[model samples]
Target: MIYDGDEVEQELCVDLYWSFRSPYSYLALHHVRALAKAYALRWNVKVVYPLAIRTPDFFKRMDHMWRPYLLIDTQRIAESLGMPFRRPVPDPIVQDPRTLLISLEQPHIHRLTRLGAEAMLRGRALELVDAVGTMLWDGSVDGWNQGDHLARAVAAAGLDLQDMETAIARDPQARDRLIETNEAELRAAGHWGVPTFVFRGEPFFGQDRVELLLWRLRQHGLQARSN
Candidate 1:
């Protein structure tokens, strides 16, 4: 029973972010729903393209070191959460700047993000976001390998994929703008990583940091002293 400060007095917005290509983002999506429910908070999913795009050489270098660390860390986290996770086949998005081959630039990604924003506008963003996030995190479906998996994920959220696609494709400028807007918002929130949570302008990066955000929320609500 947390009370909202002014305005609607019913919900608090937790800016939830993730990169479509990031395995850690996949892992973090696992616990987001439960955390939101526990805190009585509504999550606004902010999907951003990974930094790998901006730094191609950095990605190539990190591919040797950071990728292994990502795999090990994500597996450990997923095991702890008892969530099923598999290395995404084809890796969802490749770190290529020339083509933007990753799902981050896919029509599906744009459609989904737009739909998410629409949901937020309509006040049903929380539930829609939870459902979509869960499906995206459920690695049993092989998001990268399965062709129909994304459409299924979108449908599960009570959204019409065909209609969304039609709408998204019809407005290329708007899609680009949306992507740019999310990217700007991510940067403004601090770090550009997925699973980043922003509360009252404070950014907490990673699923592991979720507890920290919860603590901050509690402190804000209860007026607890910081030690």
Candidate 2:
């Protein structure tokens, strides 16, 4: 869908997503918000699990090829965007809390998605989601075991993480429903990947494709284009 810069009075909304463990997602997180603001668009963060969990063997094999590409591509993107990119001291997923690991088999996916939903509900979705993304990507904070990292990030977006945690703990069903719905929605979008952007029902997979979506938005004035 193309968004007309001139005609649209209301902000064009697009879904922004990422997997907590995805380095590419981390890279994309750095500039997605600024891009949205520049285009007068509203970003709707939709945290989803990486494709690795869905197809583990394929991901393992792909990782052999992808790791190098991930490092190189992210560095290039960081350079182009003038953003600082460093590999965090401790990997977020590898060093996560055991209790957290037990609570959610994929803690990164589950926690991110739950937080995204909560932020959406509270009307601070974009900001909170962006903060979380920065935490994951910026390389300043070791996201793995920063003690109060999540809480601080949430609070930075003006949310009460303590309350959010209480709610999530009290309502497992809610979190499950949100995750199930997110997965279903993602599948329906024709790309089972994080850092996917959906504009006017058309799915653009990968951070590299954001510019393509922007071009389409400018050209089509918010109308969906079929592949």
Candidate 3:
């Protein structure tokens, strides 16, 4: 491709549609943060509610093999990446322990998505999610939603938990709207999964596709950030 001398270079942007409950989303986040650091790329991070919320019947509709496969796959991927792995003790989404049926009244995930939206509004979505996701997904911490665990994580992300909580308290409807918009865009991009990265309308759906997203960016002449 030839560039005209007077033509301005367009900034490279990637849209990340992520969910807090997905282990793959957590795994992919580590790579996404590294990519942001190494390149002069704009990350449009949108935290969408997990499928458990958006499509309540999704798990019930999935193949029986999927659950076992996901358990095996996520752990192996974490091992391969040398990242600590553990399922959140109290799953973010409420469900029947024995039947694996999701409950209608969810207490945790809604709050998490609201906070994630607030972080996105503050333009520190990646930092917030990285810190919080680590706390929730990594084997290091238990009862992540208890005490100062969340407050410390928010502070680590360079955000104030009280301030964000206040924002949510003021207008939680607005945060849910933001998440809805992300979900719509994710579907419009031809996918419905978390950790999906969209570059110029093309969707790369899955943690394994991050490399392909990078390759596409390179084809568009993505540049390294200057020191």
Candidate 4:
């Protein structure tokens, strides 16, 4: 499916802090894209590394039940939204299977996250993530990072993977710094989570808060585009 860019007037703007490794972020894409289509709004897509990468000790500090509950809850949310849900095969962030301890040498997530930042720079952040997120989380394909899967997803988003890669390689650190800035901005917005949407300085965290976000947007005079 082709994505619609912000073709209408920029009546409102939203900052979305998304993570490639977050299943909730993947679930949130459906609503995010829908909101973009239904309203004349500008989206400032800020893709950041998941908590697993940003804070290596985050999961370790969590209760033993955190992972199980996350899986269960994300699956339920995906089903309720009629979207396919699966933990990415070879999960984006490399980790020990038995210990569930994160690895420092994370090749997959670093590259993916950097590409996300590059996409945002190219003004196709939502399109790139929407296509890539579906490919990674939809349960339709495995080895999402291998073959031409990622390249095709990038193409679907109207971008070329090689171009994006070259752009990132030119200044990889700069891309990473942008992600760090997004993390800081996210915290400043009063939340620290993937799929956090900030509108007019108010932070709405989680996929479940989409309605509330919409309600807030509506209160601020969000106007729908006439088809």
| Best candidate, TM-score | 3
TM-scores vs. true structure, each candidate: 0.76, 0.79, 0.95, 0.94
lDDT of 3 by residue, 90-153 (tens): 7899988666788989888998888999999999998888999888899777888889988999
- Candidate 2 stretches greater than 4 Å from native: 1-7, 95-109, 220-227
Q: How does residue 42 of candidate 3 score in lDDT?
A: 87
Sort all candidates by lDDT, best to worst. 4, 3, 2, 1
Segments of candidate 4 deviating more than 4 angstroms: 1-10
Question: What TM-score does structure 4 among the candidates reach?
Answer: 0.94
Q: In lDDT terms, how accurate is model 1? A: 0.63
Expressed as tens digits, the lDDT of each residue in 69-100 for candidate 4 is 98899999998999988888878999987788
- The true-versus-predicted C-alpha distance at residue 155 of model 1, in Å, is 1.1
lDDT (CA) per prediction: 0.63, 0.68, 0.88, 0.89
Clashes of 3: 0
Expressed as tens digits, the lDDT of each residue in 1-227 for candidate 2 is: 33445665555678776666676777776557657546666777766655555454444355455666877987888888777777654543433333222222455556666776767667787778667767766767864345888788888899988787778778767766766677788888887877788877899988788779878766655433232
Clash pairs, model 2 backbone: 2-217, 2-221, 2-222, 3-217, 17-195
lDDT string, candidate 1, 75-167, tens digits: 888888888767544444443534433334544444556666555444565556555555665555655335776667666777765666676
Clashes of each: 3, 5, 0, 0
C-alpha lDDT of residue 18 in model 2:
60
TM-score for candidate 3: 0.95
